[model samples]
Target: MVHSPLKLDTPQEWDLSDLYTDFDDPRLVEDLDSLQQTANQFRQQYQGKVKQLTPEQIVTCLQDLEQIYQKSGYLYAYPSLVFAADTRNTEAKQFLDKVMEALTGVDNQLLFFDLELKSLDSEAFSQLQASPALKNYQHHLIRIAELRPYKLSEEVEQTRNRDSLTGRQAFIQLRSVHLGEQEYPDVTTPEGKTANTEAELSALLYHPQEEVRHNAYSAVRTVIKEHNLLYGYILNAIAQDHKIENQMRGYPSTLQKQLIEDQVSEPVFTAIMEGTASRFDLFQRYYQLKSQEIGQKIRICDLYAPWTTQATPPLSYQSGVELLLAALEKFDINYARRAEEFFLKSWIDAKVRPGKRGGAFCAYSHGKHSYLLLSYTEDYNSVFTLAHEMGHALHFAWIDETQSYLNSNPPMVLAEIASTFNELLLLDSLLESAADETIRKSLLTRQLEDQLNLLFRQSTISRLELAVHQRASEGSFDHLFINEKWMELYQLLCGDSVELLADHQYDWARIGHIFFKPFYCYQYTASNIVSLACYQKYRQVGKAFIPGYLELLASGGSQDQVQALRQYVDVDLEDPATIRGALDYVEGLISQLETLI
Candidate 1:
């Protein structure tokens, strides 16, 4: 039986039995208390002596911290995901806010631990790690030491850290009001039929009819325009906050602080963005061809309009699971098996329901368990999303298994590698099994979509962000300035085919990252290039590439992006080849699509 789109206005529930049987179960409270006690004990014993502590003590403390942190993560993730998936859940809302408050208090107290550890002498630190446990964490120690230059005075640092919640965090929370509540009338298709809600409207954007795509785009814009003022305030507040912090941190350029935290250099970031921007002709050609395919003049909204006349046949949920697992099995059997486990164990909430979050994300609950949030529409995009999110889950599961809890989550640059790599593998596998020219072309177009999003859209957004920050810092921090800069970016990257209308000018306000992670959009472009190069190596070498991939994942927070890539991909980020290779890959796909047409 075919199911209807989820009723997003009402709260749809999931069976948390997969993670925990009940929030108030004895184990839940017991774990929280245990985690708190362990953290407290570790702090009491090693707070002052981290430098002088034995290597065994170092290892012991790290393991305990990971274990406790993981437990606390479970405590935090459960309600947080529930809250995000359904904003109207009052109990979940209260519980999550309470947990955040508690975590903030705990974080303030632990902020000094890392700064103090980084302050220790190399010789003394090495001697303490002489214990066998410390031997394995030498890389992590080196990483901590690398941050010494960025560490601030304890009093000042503590104050800065504590104040972040009320500033950046609060601003981001306010912005959430704009999302999860957008109410739009049903979007009408060419047949004069309506698909209710934005998600359905988004699916219709791919309809072969130009009228349908245009109407869908216009409908969504009308909804967005309604909340323009509040959204504008959120954008201005968040960007200004970043501008203030960047100045205080003494970052040399607009993006320097983000690049440093990403464990990359400014030159590397420039190489990635500049190289991609230089190849605009390749995308222009593709868009022009796509425009020809539709036999009409295409605009920016038409870029994502389905290029094929044939509707992509939808696979059932079970079949989608099999397809994802089958594709992942090409890389490693273990990858396939873990994904299969997720399907059978209810690790995924696949049901479409009201108040469930519209997007897909993998939430790793501090330790071994990982949960996936997706409002499944049972489309090909949904299957690809499952594959993508599962890739993230498996990566987290592996890192969590291999590293301390504190170290399991890698920097954002590395996080995208595994996810995008999974996508490349899926595309490669799908193309191999294509039964007809139509499916092959569709798959090729999907791949281009990936390239367009991560490489083109992200890079353009990055450029826009830099301009916005620089302009804001120069006392041009007004809505008009932001609109102008936003339009300039749209025109530059999207080419002459697309026009930015006045109402659409406030597009910057809708982006959540500008409010959350300063200058994070570029990482998508950075990681996209890196993933392409890494996947190319894997294709060239087979299982031999597995070692480097595994090592990169296992390294987690122990190494920076450049060192990690140096070990794995053997290409320096500053080299034009690193970015050029990925862009060339995009060009090759566009070439294939051209031939198909």
Candidate 2:
């Protein structure tokens, strides 16, 4: 049993002593120097000899590469987390830069290894992939094979690796620091207080009170507008960087590259996009009802407003843990135990503070336990976020328990799938036990809004992303071009249910994904379509489905994405209605909310 600390924020910090003693840790410097040495030694011995290696030699070679990869993962994880906690910390920032530059150098040295492997003749490639000793790395070999067509020359690959530190990655680093260091003017609230950071203000966007939500929206707009020029410049640089890299790599299009990387076929990707976009009517209908519930026309700012004005009691950090653990217990005792370790062991950073990153992510290093980042506002959504991020932590944790480092990564959609599953589990647990109609209504509305964001909004965002990359390939991106593209997406999704706000067009200006990972948001749409169907299956079958679902998690990238999902939950990603099942589920939630209204 774990006892919660009296103050949540006090224990919210993770014990990074596990990763390093400090930025000044001699081991960090030693490890940085050692990475290049290891890479050079390995390359010197194996660069042109991959096809000549026996089974034992192949396994040994892979193990050597795995060691380097794991060390690099840990080295990168620490400074990145440190920077995330306080992007303005000059020491952490500088060390992060140094580490990134050093790793780039190391990777540049290793570039020739992959180029050599991919250049092998058909017989050599076949024999290596068929070796019994290399079975554990089969998935890794296949992943490498997937990139054969995209692999550039050794010199070009080396140049790209060397430039990564100062090119797109630098601009993304700036965006993170900029958002963290932003100072939004305080919005006075009914409780005689001010909301400061983006996370705090984001919580206000869902406040039951309309005025507070509007004020929060206005303040965010003011801050983003204040820095629009620099933000726009950063986005343009990122866009152009991708454009250059994508063209040089021979990728026909940006989305195609992302799709291949995600292990999703073009047909299934299109199915997800069209299936979700076809339901814009459901989106409009939900908002029309939401406008009536709020007793006013729903403004762009009013989108996240609660479906009710009912007040929710404040939940402390300790209580949030108990609540999430209790919810997890219904699924399985093991699930609860895994989640409990996150709180008791202090694997999570939960406090809302100045200079912390705006959104949340779970960082998993192959040999170390996962670390979670949450700008916890202690609201109801924060409670769900606790469960959601823990789902991610444990997903990778389970993978580590059973898989080798070579195949530990799942598709990016797995990130959303596990997180959203916990969210649904928590909702089901809440709705099953709660007697009050208002609480049930609130929970249902919360589910609806989440589905809205993950399904409808993300699909639209992906459409806009494709257009941005296309236009960006032709010329430099300007404010007018991005703004117009965004407005088009908003209108397509929202229909004419409410007046469109121009500030909404500037919304992409604040999205880090556009700059950091081109076309990354579609995975949310893809995962939601898959997860909703999985949840519905669980509801229908009860405990019978646990073994397969857990196996799916343990498989990591071992199985094909579509095949794994199909085997576990009978979900057919190729079918257009795979997402329609999710839309139907959302419609059901809206129906329940209607009755309560």
Candidate 3:
């Protein structure tokens, strides 16, 4: 039987029985116990003996580590998936809390093995890599040696791990809990005061009516403003935490080590950041043209407002599945088949309900099923989100079949490629089959705006991240200071195209990335640029490029971002032309929108 689209106005549910039958599932406790025991056993066997082991013993250690990691995945993801679906559930929260402590202990037990490996000198690591038995493990060892240069002493490492629960994690939980309990009234829709969470408020920013949209933004801004002192203190503390850690680790700056971890050099990161800024003209031109289309000056709140005269009707969940599945079919039969399973096997939770976490994410369990959490609103945008997460599912599915658990984690810089690629395919399919000029125009506009969002807007926030982190290091990350500093970034990012209001000053206060992962926004720009290169190849070479792209995804972290891309599509990120691909893609999108108008 075919199902209908999940209407957000009502409660819709997703089944998690595939992973666990219930909160008290017997397997939950068993899995946790198994992980703890396994970790202890592995540590006892090889913790300090890593360097002394023969090449064959090292292979055995890797095999054991893989099993341990795969088991931990099941244990960690169960409570995590439950908590995300409804953060207010007390039992779910408790389970997650207990599981985290258990996992942390397990991680500490296994920590010595990694620390010893990372501490190896270049010559020692080279000799280890020279083992033919460790041939497939070269990239993993190289990464260890590369990062070990930034490694801490055993004493410092232990203290850092133990203190995380009380330190960084406590601050993160504070923000998460506040957002969960906090509710705002949707003041725009008359006689209408619904209990709106932050997620609902943010989603309403896309409402068709201009007043409804801006009102949502206003309501959120007001709420955040009232709690500015608390939020601002939390933000600064997180930044301060990072700055101190960077200093103790002997790094030059905070983001420098992050670039290193992503296997991207500082120069490449710099070129992409500077290149996106140099083309701020395109950002201005798009918005100025949008303002003309809407017959008013664009405001910061109106940035996401749909400008098309008539948007296509709300896309249903059933139709969304069919649309995305059909798009995947053109690439490979296997890709389409896996997407079909998402609908047939009840793998997706397409719903809008209370207590659910905001935003969408795909988590692929080691050697098991891939789960996705999304608050589907049944719009053109929501359908693409489904496609996007499904892309992540498929990305891991390929890797699972071809790789071991040790090599399954792809770098964040390359992680967004599959998901965004799915969006591209779905968008092109919709545009190709669009019934009229208005529909086509809407599709084109969304593509352009999203491209700019991922490429340039993320870069702008990255700029904000750098500024705030630097200021925090100087003891100046205050509420008023953040407002003024963010305003400066606003002018740099938007120029004079969009009107900035007082409410816009506190917009940075709502950005979670600054608190969660400092200097991480640039990954979006990097991945989007790489995805564009992949998409361009598909368009140029047609079906012939499908194998290479799938092969790239299957390689996972076995190859670094640049190495994997070179093998598949010859994309050299360090090359100026490849970095400019992002700029060129935005310009192409703007040109397309111009012709449509």
Instruction: Compute each candidate's TM-score over C-alphas.
Output: 0.90, 0.97, 0.95
Q: List the residue pairs that clash in candidate 3.
A: none
Q: What range of 10 consecutive residues in model 3 has the weakest lDDT sum?
A: 1-10
| Candidates sorted on TM-score, descending | 2, 3, 1
* Model 2: how far residue 108 lies from native, Å: 1.5
Preferred candidate (TM-score higher): 2 or 3: 2
What digit string (tens of lDDT, one per residue) describes model 2 on residues 4-30? 343453428777878898977899989
Model 3 lDDT tens row, 210-269: 787788888878877888888878888878887788888887787886777777888888
Candidates 1 and 2 compared: the better one by lDDT is 2
Q: Candidate 2 vs. truth: CA RMSD?
A: 1.8
Per-residue lDDT of model 1, residues 1-597, tens digit only: 112222233212356674567556677567666666766766677677666666666677777666666667777887777777676677876777776766665655566577777777777766654556676676667667666666776777767766766776777876664466666667776566676565666667677777777777777777777777677666777777777776766766557777766677777777777787888777778778888887767775677777776666656666666667778887888767776777656677766654555567888875567788776665677678878888788888778677766566688888878888888888888888888888788888988987978887888878878887776677646666677877877777768655445556765666667767777888888888888888988999898898789778766765566777798667566678878888889888888777877
Query: What lDDT would candidate 3 get against the real structure?
Result: 0.80
Question: Candidate 1: TM-score?
Answer: 0.90
TM-score of 3: 0.95
Name the candidate, 2 or 3, with the larger lDDT value.
Answer: 2
- CA RMSD for every model? 4.0, 1.8, 2.6
